[model samples]
Target chain A: MALNQTLSVQRLDDPAPDSPIIEISHLQKVFAQRKKAPLEAVTDFSLDVRRGEVLGLIGPSGCGKTTILRMVAGLDSPSSGSIVVDGKEVTGPGPERAMVFQDFALLPWQSALENVVFGMAATKLSREERVARARAELARVGLSGFEDHLPKALSGGMKQRVGLARALAVNPTVLLLDEPFGALDAQTKTLLQDDMSATLQEEGCTTLLVTHDMSEAVYLCDRIVVLTNRPARISQAFSIDIPRPRGERFRSTPEFTELVDQVWQELKAHVTLSNSQAVVEG
Target chain B: MSSSIRTAWVAFATFLLLLAGWWGVAAIAPSSYLPTPLAIFERLVYFVVEGGLLDDLVSTMINIAAGFFIAAALGIASGLIMGVSRLGRDTIGFFVDVFQSAPSAALVPIIVVILGFGREAMITIVVIFCYFIIAVSTAAGARSIESGLHDMSATFGASRWLFFRKVLVPGSMPMIIVGLRLAMARAFNGGILAELLISIRGFGGKMMYFGGAFDFASLYALIAVALVLTFASMAVISLVGRQLIRWT
Candidate 1:
């Protein structure tokens, strides 16, 4: 254990090229809800996200999928374990990794264009360049004409697109999406999923998405990592060997159903285990 | 433009009707206290045409402006501190309670005695009176920011400075504007109160002077001017706040 800790620390400290984009080992998160006993949100989680790979984390509700994603994104800290992204240990948030939140956390005061430009401002980009780049990104996200519209005025899908544009504007090496399209209508979710898959493919940036939707995971992910409920640990990792440019037909194929069933089986056991724990605790 | 003109016409009509009613009541009663619209208007015109009403008005305006700006600067700074930090919240919370409950009239004698009867005393009184409202409201606004937004920004890899610059400022603006509007009304009242008690050169001072000499017409005219200033300031605050709401 000491040797692993030393290796993890060394791996994090060095900014070498060959290191995985994200490495997490024996990660745990405990939340203390004032006066109540601490709840173990996540536990003994371990995973590696290779550069340019799209990794999906799938689990039932309360399975700590979002917690894992947040920890990877450096939004929250692990109780124990090391998280190294791009060969650097993430102690706090840095611009190297950008996130698209579940609720589409766009600045309501800023227009879509302004929101995108805001993300780019922390970098060395000039104001004019930021504007131009922001415009291009908005156009890429199919928001060319609605540049001046505020987040409140935009539809859920549109708002999510703006969130995506804002994250992409930073030109980060890793993109962390916490159910970026979870709140949208089914049609909107499908459209956004396609856009997201295409965007990641085009950018070739490492992605780690947390989702409950099995189809979304199979469609977009290079590998889907299933987790056991509460004190979550990786139960299985399934590599999707499907060809790219997946359409509606791909979603209905036998291959897709088999993968979904496989994930669902792992998920069912975890759900049962969590329910029994709740009953016992109660 | 046309709709605004209609609004102006409606407002003017309402004012004329109110003035007519006041005149009719005064004429019917012929009391020693109340003055007619014509009498008040004559005094107002006389002051505008030949007297030092402008100078008196400007002096009072200057006092209010100076005191208001000073209070605003200090109040906003203190409010931001109180709003942003735990220590500031605890320390300022006690002062806010004391100031909010303290009577404006009660402080006039103390302020005049300490600072002496002059523009400095008047301005000082106004600043003290207005600071608490602005600061308290601003602190409330700052404290009301959603913790989730902070978490999201942090996770997105935004720095502490960036989070403050981007989220905190924009988030607090609505509340700050509310504070500003509330503070403006208090500031105006403080200015007038200070002049009534401590200064010899403002509209409020003029009102007291005319009232003491049994010059009811001029006193009423000065009162009207004060009302106009208060309403106009309120209007400006409302317009600015509306614009901010629209932007968000």
Candidate 2:
């Protein structure tokens, strides 16, 4: 990164002060499909995301972490309760939030430049300003000179970079990621994780991530919250004590491994109980 | 070599083989009924230069083009509506299914009585045959876009127009083009039928005139021109479609 020398670490190895930018209270979601049993995804969930802190949501496969993330993005509604961003009650989608999807959700018809420009499409900014900002953001994400390439022509990593550029281009007050690197291969995910660490450090936006990987949560989040499967609740929350500017060396640190193991231990017991119960029912 | 060039060469080879086969068939059949390749070629040139038949061809094309554009506009609109709205799909979807398969020729006699024998009637007939196919294609195309994509757009606060223009139109394009190809092919077929049966005018009428006079060579020439136009349009469309959906 060209800005690496200028980049301040902005490390919060200590717990952040209670300056909550995003507040969720008694949030719940229930899916009612016709001709099928109702599925309760989340129940009695509440959390406050501190300003400039990366908060991670990790849970079992169907724990509704994505549902909670979507609700915060204002794409889904809570069956009951409220989500407030910057003290304004979020009813529907607003430009103050940007989401990075797991599937790379890039519109196939548009080129990377156009896709990145999509972020500012809802804004009142002049077209020239939008175009300039889009170019700058794509370049910031290391996607310079590949502006006109369509998502289909890009590799998985390149496509995700476009997604990242699209998200960060608008300069949203909140950053929401639903397994942003989940679809990438191990090598690519690792590389992206490092890049994301740098980007998140630089942007310093309030970040919320939903992931299945414990170590990934530990690596990226200042605080990681684990949820229970089906009718999800905050089972536990861990404050990651690992130092920032996370590099390859961070993965092997004792604190990092110990934290991951602790999360695994809790999640493992839950999974085993659920599996044995399913076997008995079957 | 590039795939497009390889395809062009293969197409050329196919045409050559078809011509050779036609010549062989003409040699086997009686001279009065089936004209030789050289005979058709000569008659084609004569019509182009002396008979003023290009005007008739142009007239037929104008009707086809009119019907095509109208159908494309309406079909895309209806398709997008159907794809997005469940109520719209439920209400009009049945009509789309029934009319798309209805023998296009049957509609001509009924339409002819109402609109009278003219270009308007023929254009209407062509549109009736074409629009349903295009609509069905686009609707299916629109439905195929994943829900995650829509969620992403909504999360980013995409306006309704932006969603339709950037998301729906482009997402459904691959199938929409396929539908266009099918609809255009039907347009030519419908145009020929309407012209042949309606008032004995345009390229279709010229074909009929040659046949009634027992001029096999000229009839073959007209058919050959029609065939060439059909293939040419399809080739151009496929090339454009390839360019549009390169990402997939």
Candidate 3:
């Protein structure tokens, strides 16, 4: 249950940072197959992620949350509609949006330090500058001592931390996290969520996190976006008002419980709808 | 040290057993078909002292080196291209199947006649023999690259050239090295066969010559040297592969 804590809002008079770092409009994505059924993964999904705001997307598995994120990240193209990031339509992958993949996706041949360095190299940073920046980013992710270790040698959490450091090193305007902490143990996940939230706040970067964990979304995000199952659409969005530096105690509040129930109820209805649709289609 | 000592003792016992078996067979048969172990050992020492085998061995080494280099260069380049592009993959894939399945050894006499027996002819044969193996391995290696790494590079704005140089090359290195090892073994066998039929300046030719002259001891000694060379090549490849895997 998410707390009913009135989601905090930026001062109305204060200008929003640079006008929607990511603006996705009516995006539709369909995965077509030959001699089989066609899959509509996302349908007319739209959202505006403003600068310096953490937007969490929570849905059941295969509800097209990942498809939305991938389209926004420019890893996949939308079948219809435009994705304008920083006012430019995205047709392919660009450095402006850096993604932290679910699996850490680090190059196996590279060490943690080298992975960070490679990410920073996109901006044409000098070799020394790249190294220094990589060290600083690794330290930021609490990986100061494991810089020289390969990804295979690290635990899943540590590897994801390396993935985080790699994305942060790029200094992108928007960060796309596709269930970045899904693979970690509960303790590690909680700790990493705190670390990631703190880092996103400090960096003042726009973020889109796709996750199945409702609590995680409620904890870290300024707003939560819910998507309906296959051929998913924006079912609803909720604002989370917990203050900065939100800690464990926040999860226990009456407000949090109210909001969590509200979102879960909506999600259950969507799931039922998905099942009926599946049965009919089958 | 203990393990090495144990290994040495085992090796010594094995050698003694082999020698005794050979001598026993020779004493009972008194056959011209087989030479005594002692006679072969003495002949080997004499050949080394007289440098009779050195020239032949050097010639074979040169041919193998030249052939292996050419095969490696062509194979790796073509393999990388085929692996990276769908069109290249489709085109070269068919050629690889043909070359891999065709009678490689059967082409030896034809190549010898066409090229006119010389160093070039031997090298051509060895190169043709090893190329398909190396190319197919390298191509398969490139194709087997993890999609995550490819996406990672693309997300980082890696240009095609940079991606190939930094990502694809390192990722495929281990498999490519394995391909090289396979090619080296093939080249060795091809080199020996080429020497036997077309040239008089390699160990293979010397072996044939000794056999014809009734110098069975020298022929056996040459066979032993060839075995040692093959083993040495395998050892070198393994050592190099271990170092490469560690560094990567």
Candidate 4:
């Protein structure tokens, strides 16, 4: 549900800061399976993400938004292009970048607090300090009383919250979230999105989010990049000029509605095209 | 009744019925071929107190312990190595399959020949029989760890030792314990078979000697002792195993 409170659009200077923290140039990804034709997921895609700004990537199914995020996170190697973070190219998954997986990949054997602590295990921080930080991190995620619960005991939303806390606990220079709220019900998704957005901004984290939800992109991202279907290239990138410290009422604002409508309209064509192609092939 | 109580009563009923059937058959059968239940019980007590049965029990228990211990250690170590290393798996996997399929029981005569028909040879046979099963099971457990978890570990920059301790050991524990249970059972078979085949001075050798001498009551007593030993050992191992892996 969107809040109906309407107010005139108050101007804010440059919705996102001008300083860029992540630079992607002509990035391409292709995967091969046995006896199958090589699948080209992305090609010739490029974008710059500003420091302390959330960037959302939206596209049709199989459009390779997650592949781009993984390359940036250093979990997957780029086929032909480079992802430079703070001027250094990413070689592999490193301590400076942490990923919040779509699957909520918390280790099953670990308690929520232990999962967060595990994220910082490789750091040179003292064990006592890591434990304290993990406690604070879990508290920040609204899981203060449930710190001892294992992933099997938690609901999907709670597990995801733990995933977010784990990434945050690492104090990464870059945060990569792949469909962070995709598995949740709409109500839980909205609430978590709001809480997580506020916490992320408060921490001044540089985030790259991949989502299929157009409204979610409008709600959270400072900029949204839409990609074409497979062999994905950036079709458009829009800067969201909505004021910061957005409230529930902001969702009902004409500007927010307009942005959401625009993104949906832009994305609808890609979805329709993919579906029609699939039908034709079948 | 609660399931545990029901299970206990069912087992008790089964034992009572089996004992009654044995007693009935023994009453009709010749004393030389099938001793009466009361006679077997008396002989069992006599053997335990006066006929050197306790010494054989101690000897058999020691051999089984040495064989099982060496099997468990070597099996787990080699299994982990084969699981973690591609070269180790490739070089050793073929031999493991061959050894597992070969039926080590048939090799007793060959083993006695090479090792000179003694306690050492019997121990070697048990180790061989036990380790094959344990190694295969351990390797399967280690190798079956999900690839996603491995990727998670790598992404989190976990060191090799940390990954092994936090991921491999705990993840494979339940499977390893199951393998140990099965290996211990097989160790009993191997140890007893070796003693019987080589005529060693242990429980199996005593059973063979009593059987050849028309001492049916003593033979029946020896079998009952073996049955009790098997159940007792398995129960002990399973109880210890449950304590170790209560998480699963």
B-chain TM-score for every candidate:
0.86, 0.93, 0.88, 0.91
The segments of candidate 4 whose C-alpha lies over 4 angstroms from its true place after superposition are: A1-17, A249-258, A273-282, B1-42, B214-217
Q: Quick one: best DockQ, which candidate?
A: 2
lDDT string for model 2 (B55-159, tens) is 899999999989988999999889888899998798767788777778878778899889989889999988987899999999999999999889988988888
| lDDT for position B244 in model 1 | 76
Compare candidates 1 and 4 on TM-score and give the better one: 4
For residues A98-185, write the lDDT of model 4, one tens digit per residue: 8888888777777998889888866999999999999999999999999998788899999999999989988988888899998899
Clashing pairs in 3: A1-A260, A2-A256, A2-A260, A3-A255, A3-A256, A4-A255, A4-A256, A7-A240, A7-A241, A8-A241
Interface RMSD, prediction 3: 1.9
Report the candidate with higher lDDT, 2 versus 4.
Answer: 2
- Candidate 3: segments with Cα more than 4 A from true spot: A1-18, A252-258, A269-282, B1-31, B34-36, B214-216
lDDT values for all models = 0.81, 0.86, 0.84, 0.83
Q: How many angstroms is residue B93 displaced in model 1 relative to the true structure, after the best TM-score fit?
A: 4.2
Q: Among all windows of ten consecutive residues in candidate 1 chain A, which has the lowest summed lDDT?
A: A3-12
Q: How well is each residue in A1-282 modelled by candidate 2, as lDDT tens digits?
A: 322322223232333477799989899999999998888999999888999889899888777899999999998889999999989998988888999999999988789999988877788889899889889988988889999998878889999999999999888899999999999999999889989988998999999999999988888888788777767888777776555658767888776677688778767865666567567857
| Candidate number achieving the greatest TM-score relative to the actual structure | 2
Q: Tell me which residue pairs clash in candidate 4.
A: none
Q: Global CA lDDT of candidate 3, please?
A: 0.84
Write out the backbone clash pairs for model 1: none
- How do the residues A1-282 of candidate 1 rate in per-residue lDDT, one tens digit apiece? 332221121222333344578988889999988989898989888777889888899987788999988888777899999999888998987888888888887778889998888777457879899899999989999999999999989999999999899889889899988998899999999988888888888898999999989889989988788888877778777767665556667777777787677678767888788789788988
